[model samples]
Target: MNMNRTVLYKAALPIVMVLICAPYKVNAYNIEDAIKAVQLNNNGIKASKENVNIAKTERAQAYTTLLPSINLSNANTRTTYDVPQVLPNSSSGDRRSTSLEVYQALFEGGASLFRIDAAKHHLKAVQSDHQSQVQEIVFKAMEAYERLVVIKTVYDFHVKNEEAMQQHLNGVEARFKVGEATVTEVAQARASFEIAKANKNVSSGEITALEASYESITGEKAPQNMDPVDISGVYIPSSLDELMQICLKDNASIVALSSSIESARGNTRVAYSGLAPKVIGAINVNATNIKRNSPYKQDGTTYMIKVNMPLFNQGGIEYVKIKEAKHRERKQKAALESQKSAIISAAVGIWTKYSSSHSTIASMAEAVKASEIALKGTIEESKVGTKTITDVLEAETKHLDTKIKHTQAIQEQLLAVFQMHQIMGTNLSMFTNTRPIVQTAFNKS
Candidate 1:
């Protein structure tokens, strides 16, 4: 039995060794996943969804105005003395009655229809608003994700720089001991090393803060491994004019304002309805007994057609309301135009930044390459006693700065593209294939 157990242990030894030695594959968290998480967990998105529901309920209530109203009532009364009854063949005594009535509006100058239209348009406006809010939150998440990546890159650069500086300081100290370097040179190298160390620490702190921010936005702990963002799949129009046209047509904020204008116009029509005559039709069925003890009862059915003409309101309030509604409609129109202009301006600015950053990346990349070559050459020259340590240190610093700037330029370009998506109201659909959370009944066009 002991021999069999030894043989079993030996058989499993290779498998255990492989398991311990092999690298574990960590799944990379990506921008698409981050966006999906934020959409599901964000409080702002949940609130916006609630607003859409409220608008839907308001729209349903508006449609109910066109339907008939019904009421049923019953009453019982007693008197000390006998009372005469108005209806024929009714005894004089206590009375009990029950009524069923229904009222329907036949016409009010299309006021009911106008109210329905207004509600419909208002629903569209809120839906657009919700879309806009979603885009804003998405942009924020992208911003945070990109910023975290850049900071991480910067932190890595700082760590490398610190290592390089430490090596240089060690060489300087060795040279000083050999009577080949001065005390001032040694101090300078030490100072540069300290600076690099401080920068690394600062970047490390930024990473912690950014990770917390990511958690706050996504309601998930930030992943240790994150895939680099890929912006190549995102599409952008070449010409500024074409992009602007798209923005005007598809931007959620602009769409919302346009819907608001239409809603306001509908409300104005509803206010004008107050000047027209209103027609209503009502039906009533009632049963009454004048004496509770008596078996005799009277039943009646009544039909009514009522018309109310506005000769003059009590204080000309209808006319004032009409004027106020018109003013509100005009205000909405003005606001729409202003929003359009603002969106155009923003589009132009982001386009400019994207163009600049796109060009800057190429130039900065070349600068980094040149700085690397220069630093190498300077270090070689200093080793032969032809160049000073100061020159080598300067080149090293320049190379590091160039690398950082190149990273920043790349981040800026990516962010500008995302901002364009935000302006075009397409960010929500850019990365995912899921259906929209809020939908409106009206056609987008």
Candidate 2:
């Protein structure tokens, strides 16, 4: 019993130690699950959310500026003079003073109101940017998912092709033993088998890398049997004009840049307001307490109206900012134009790719069928000595290549459809059957 216990402990110890040291395994994620996890956990999305919060607070602060301002202050001092101060007759054990001041802005040449507007616009821009970031992350997750699925499918075919080549090699060797096949034929078959093995090994390595990439993006391991998204039945725009119209309303980049332009215009108005004087209403109350001899007193409240004019601060102050704001507005407008151009270009490119992939897939499908039939016929002929061993092997390799190309065409078509959806700024919520993952931006009345 002691010996048996020792053996079991030895066997279990490594497993226990490994479990303790190994990295914690995350749960598997499907497409929708992966996007949700990213929204919750991705570091970039986290930072972008923080930016939205900052924008929200800044906008609130802008609104606060339109309200009254109040301040409270106090001061205390203890002094002991070797000789009693005579002129003012002030000899203090402790002198305490408190003041309350209020400054209400009656007017600021509309700069404050414009600043508030600018802050609000900036907030909107950042919110839109955050949404764009979410979409980008979703697109990346989808790409990773597709890559892993397609590559795995490719890997499976390579494995089967390798097996087929191995069988062919064995047949060729048997024929050579019977003097029915030449040594060169056997050598060729062996070489083809090795090449297929190398291809399978290479694809295996690709699968490992793709799996890691998928995990890194989704924050979890992918499931073994991933149901690939079939975008074929998804909506496709009828024409480029329809796509352009949708893009005009839905593209996040254009929306963000347009908001930025409005913000810049507001800031420009604010900068020009510096040329006018600011009217402020102010009041202050003073309360002071001296020693027991003096007691405490409350001074009368002082009320005053103050006007502050911007004198001069060279060219570095409001003047430069006004000019800079104008230039910035122009720059942003140019950027928006450029972005629209790029969006159109991308939409056209994807549409073309998807359109072509349809025919490419059909053609490749036919090629695969013909090659399969040719391989079978060639194999029969080779067994009957009417065809050389080399012809049969060549036909088999051609069939495998044709089938791989057909699969690749299918993958491209699917990805093109997904790409079209992404480029058109389709709501990310559409990716799931459940509730939407992203909020749709609404136009204000």
Candidate 3:
């Protein structure tokens, strides 16, 4: 008897362990917390922020051209002289000198001035780029979050459907045993259960794939049973014209491109400044020992300013540099226009999706309801020998299809709202609480 009991215990242990662990496995992460965590931890976003900081440092350096460059020098030399033994004692002679020099560029044609402007503009562009990164990372998290939700919903639905298919197959098999259902009906019911089992497996696989994506963004295991997203603040503009205008004024990509153009123009001016005359001023202060044996010292100060003009370039290098900058400016201008066009197209596409998803969700909701009622009626009628097993299975399949479609529509609607925010360049606000220290986009300013 003890041996029999041990065998039973060993047979049941795996199932018991699975039961104990399953309930504790799911972790539900808050969406806001995930967004904040990604912002703080994501490596790419951190790198872009560093780029902004670098731009700020360059801006300060650009201002240094307006300041003088100072140099300090000190030199000490010692010489030892040995007298003959009959003569006096050996002596050491030392000489010390100190000098300070300052050189100030009173003028750099206008290169320094243009560089200062270029630095600020480039900083502005970098700031825009940083904001864009913040938006992108947040959107990735949101996308993964929403997709996980949809996958979980569908996965749960498939689980339930599979259970129902199993029950139906059991009932048909029992009826075949009682000689009430044909062998063909039993086979058909068993075939439907196998398909349902396959569907459940597919949904389970999708849930796992989505969880991996979710973890990659938020660095956490996906939380199950996420509450529906609350997009109460999302809205579409009344007309395409309004959206286009808003995008033109506020989109970060366009803002960055505009800043790049301004920076390129400043660079061109800096190159032009190289061809202009320059003025420089210098001052020198020197102190030196008058003699090695004497304790006297001499100190003198000199000051001078000079004007310099460039007569020619050896290989037209300066002119070519200006031309290169101008070409970059043109490219930036063209890119800005292209970005605007793309934004307009995206707005139209999202609007269409958002509008269509509204209809689809509603239509699918009704279809699911109708299919559920039909399924119930078909099952009842089949039990009375009126509806075939095939009819009942078809209705079950239709119901499941409608339910999955409805969930997909919901996912699309959610993503479309986010896409609208992305298009309008307001997505950063949705994820981050702290505003930028310096506003880059003119519209935001």
Candidate 4:
């Protein structure tokens, strides 16, 4: 008992240590997060995993095609009538006998090898498809994450503007009550205030919708006050050709298509592999008892070996080869077309936006600077009775518009960067490299 206890303890110690030493980690699973959740949880991936298991089982089954098969039989007979012998009348004798038979495959038309190879190729195809599905999910997550970030930033901007406008309105209302301001100015301030509030509501709704989509993909609630990405320092490709090259090399769709082409080629190999002859050998043992309706007695044993060759298959094999070849051709063509389309679309969209947004940003920055100077001049002139209250209000409004536009320009640039990244799969590494700020926030408690 003591020895058994010691053995059990020794057996369990390693398992306990392994469990304790495992890594404890969590991720925000945002746009930057690895899209493992989607792949790990997606129904498609589950099916792919099952297909891999099925392939293994099929390989085992294929091996059995060469193994020997056995059969056993026993029978008892009793004669009730006499039979005539060669010399005179004679009685028939009762007899009981048991026979064992075995058959083994000695050769085949390479059917087993073809079956195994086909199953293996299918397994590889499913694995490639699983990887493709993973890439697709990651792209989707990136899209959702970026949309949420855009909405949050825009909403915050509107909320800040609303607060500032509310304060200005309050001040203007007090001045009007003291006969220091016109009713028209007060009404104008009120109108601007209402517009800001409406914009804030709309932006907030957009944020909520984006948040819901993010959560649905991740199966987790998002953190509050999630900060937008800081892509100000991201490198932009210089030209359309440069962008196209990167996308061709990195795009998930392109990668998936490439993998599929390989898989189709593998299928073609499997189909043609059937043309080769198969050789196999097997041993079998069969036993039977010479007892009537009894399971207690020992029996005789027999062994056998056999071989089979296919001369004609009624065109079944030929049909399969032709079908596989055609399917492979179709897959190859489809992959080529898909890669071409993705590259062209990414190149045009990113290049056009990259150029336009850069110009817009420069122009917006200048406009904001000019608006600042104009607002200051208008305020000075109004104090000296050279400008009316309307002129000052108009200047302030223009400055605000320019500031907002500049913010929008920055947003457009960030969005453009994300779009470029989507075209290039390597951009996902940015999310992988950057640690979420919320990690420390949560750890502090």
Candidate 5:
């Protein structure tokens, strides 16, 4: 029994060791995961959320202006001298009193209503600003993600180019020993190999910087493996006009500015309200002791109506305020137009880049293929003494350059598509499969 148990243990030991020593497989982190992390952990997004909350509180405060104000008061007093009798039996040095009052504004020349309207619009503007902040963060995350992918590709190509150059140099050196290759050929091959190494090092540095940026934005370390962003199915407008129209209507910046303009107009109306009268209605109930230490009491109810009209001020401040508000309204209107023009210009530039990247990518891809074939042919001809080492190295350099360009073009196109969606105020959730934080916050608020 002991011998049989030993044999089983020996067989199981290898399996156990293998399980413990093998590297665990990590899942590939994708663009969706990165964006989700940003939404959950980014400090800027949290701050923007607080701003939205503040705006909501302000709106609620404005609504309270329309509600009646109620007050309850109680007072006790003692005096050194005896009180003079005002009522038939009232002669008290000490007295106690209580009162309850309710007051409501009957009219305020629409100023209160205008202030409420302004608050509502201001809340909307804040919400839109929050959305803009979210979209900006999302775009930056996507850009960083794509940049890492492209740099990795380029780095890999550079490594391959280095290896190929090394091999070519070895071949040239061997031929020089046999007097079949000149010293210049070997020197050229060495230079090309060193250049490839330097290119690889530069790419490595860029990757490190980009990873740090990714962590800063997402509040997490970048994954060792990241899945490439796939933008093939992302929608693009059929025409520039369509894109411009969409941006003017839905872009967060544009929406925020439009709301601000409305808020400014409301403020102008409020300022103008200073020219009209204000009417207030109030009801009061009171009870008071008529005599010190006496059970006898006096009770009364009062109704009052007050109207206030501003005939003039020391400096005509009301008129000055109206003028100031009108100037502010005009400023907002000008800002709105400026924002529209900027958005249109930005949209056109992004569209132009998106449209051109397709052709660029196709052309670069073809160039890569041609340069690859040419390198192979040049290498073969060099071996047969029909091509110099310089020709072969040049072909290798062209091939590497083309491959790098092709990779960059692909990443640029992907980034542009995402930028387009961002500017259009469309939800990135359609692509990310996660609900947008902006929408979630709005719903909660």
Candidate 6:
């Protein structure tokens, strides 16, 4: 029974120890925070939101064309008649009129229907534009957040290196007093320590600036030491063709450009409709009264229906020159194609950088392992006076340098990978725990 217990203890001890020494993990920033920091805070999103409201109001106005428009007016007039200038029963005539007139659209060569169609498309375009703004702000905020993490990591490493160099300088000074090291060695150590200090100061300043910029973008204080992503495994694209397809379908830039093109097309149709004839059926009731101070009065009322249509337009040349109507349509289509091409190019570049950075990180990892071994050997030899203080310092410097380089390479690789995912317009939920905010700006309309 004792032997069995011992075997069990031996088996579990290694596992327990590994668990205790594991690096502390942290939660990633959620997408909700990003949405609040970006979509809510961004000026572009605010403008787009207003545009959505305007589009909805415009659509409501267009619908009114199908209904009757009514107007009410009241007026009073008094005039003294000229002496017989023309059969003046214009007897110091006083007149008062009150009337209401209304018109209902019955038909107009399909123009009204086309206008309604155009308005609906215009509203859809506005909605798409608003979403585009939200996406853009989210992207910018994420980039700034990631950049801040990289800066903080690099700054922390520099601080550690400075402390390590200071310790080496102190040891070298002690050795010099003991006649084991020369003043020249002490001076060299001091100089290296100073340079390390300078580098640390520069890193600290850079971190401060980056933190400020990050705060500005988020409209909130930057979180301390956010957990950096631990990316592993090389990305192997299925094929370039697949990537192209993804961009064509999911790229927000292209989607926005296409929306613009559709909106422009609708506007062009509306402009051309102006050349067509318009007709409306109408009925109006009106009454006028003429009064005399001696208590005489005259009154009349009338009811009528009327229709009006355009016969000729002298403005055809000007209408044809409304370049905006056509240019906007063509420009948006061209821009959509250009955006797709640019996204494809960017994805290819990011993938290549990810590949190169992956290899660099691997090579630096090996270098760090070698340096660690060398550092250990030099420290063991230093106690026996075989390894001089300068030699130990050199080995320490090289080891620290390799460690920093390795960390940097890791950071670059993670950023490149994220960038590639960004280009593909992957869902934010994949990397974050929170979801995007609900947009209800046009819910009522």
Q: Identify the runs in model 2 with alpha carbons over 4 angstroms from their true place.
A: 1-29, 77-95, 289-298, 314-316, 433-445
At residue 327, give the lDDT of candidate 2.
98
lDDT, model 6, position 175: 82
* Worst-scoring 10-residue span by lDDT in model 3: 432-441
lDDT (10s digit) by residue, model 3, range 147-178: 88788888888888899989989998998899
lDDT by residue (tens digit), candidate 2, 159-278 = 998999999999989978998778898899999999999999999999889888877876777778766655534667787787777677788777888898999999899999887799
The runs of at least 3 residues in candidate 3 whose Cα sits more than 4 Å from the true structure, single-residue gaps closed, are: 1-28, 79-93, 292-296, 429-445
Pitting candidate 4 against candidate 6, the one with the higher lDDT is: 6
lDDT (0-100) at residue 148 of candidate 3? 80
- For candidate 4, report its TM-score: 0.68
1-445 in candidate 6: lDDT tens per residue? 9999999999999999999998996865643465467655666667779999999998888787778888888899997876677764556868888877777767665556666777787787677656555655665677677677777776777788789789888988898899877889889889878988897898888888877876666676677746554444323346566656666666555666776677677777767666556566655566777776554554444444455555556755537634668887788788878888898898788767876896898899999999999998998898897887777778878987898788878767766655655565553324442322121121114
Candidate 1: the clashing residue pairs are: none
- Give the number of the best model, judged by lDDT: 1
Clash-forming residue pairs, model 4: 106-306, 110-278
Residue 22 CA displacement from its true place in model 4, Å: 33
Supply the TM-score for candidate 6. Answer: 0.78
Model 6: how far residue 374 lies from native, Å: 2.5
- Tens digits of per-residue lDDT for model 1 on 1-445? 9999999999999999999999998768878788988898989999999999999998999899899999999999875543457544544468889999999999999998999999999999999999999989878887888889899999999999999999999999999999999999999999999999999999999999999998888788877777778766556677789779888988999989899888999999999999999999999999998875566689999999999999889888889989999999999899989999999999999999998996799999999999999999999999898889888888989999999999999999988888887888774545632332121112135
Candidate 1 positional error at 363, Å: 0.7
Structural similarity to truth (TM-score) of each candidate:
0.89, 0.85, 0.86, 0.68, 0.88, 0.78
Best by TM-score: 1
**Span of 10 residues, lowest total lDDT, candidate 1:** 434-443
Q: For candidate 2, list the clashing residue pairs, or say none.
A: none
Off by over 4 Å in 6: 1-35, 79-94, 107-109, 230-240, 292-314, 321-324, 426-445
Candidate 5: count the clashes. Answer: 0
Judged by whole-model lDDT over C-alpha atoms, candidate 5 comes out at 0.86
The Cα local distance difference test for each model comes to 0.87, 0.82, 0.82, 0.65, 0.86, 0.70
Return whichever of 2 and 6 wins on TM-score. 2
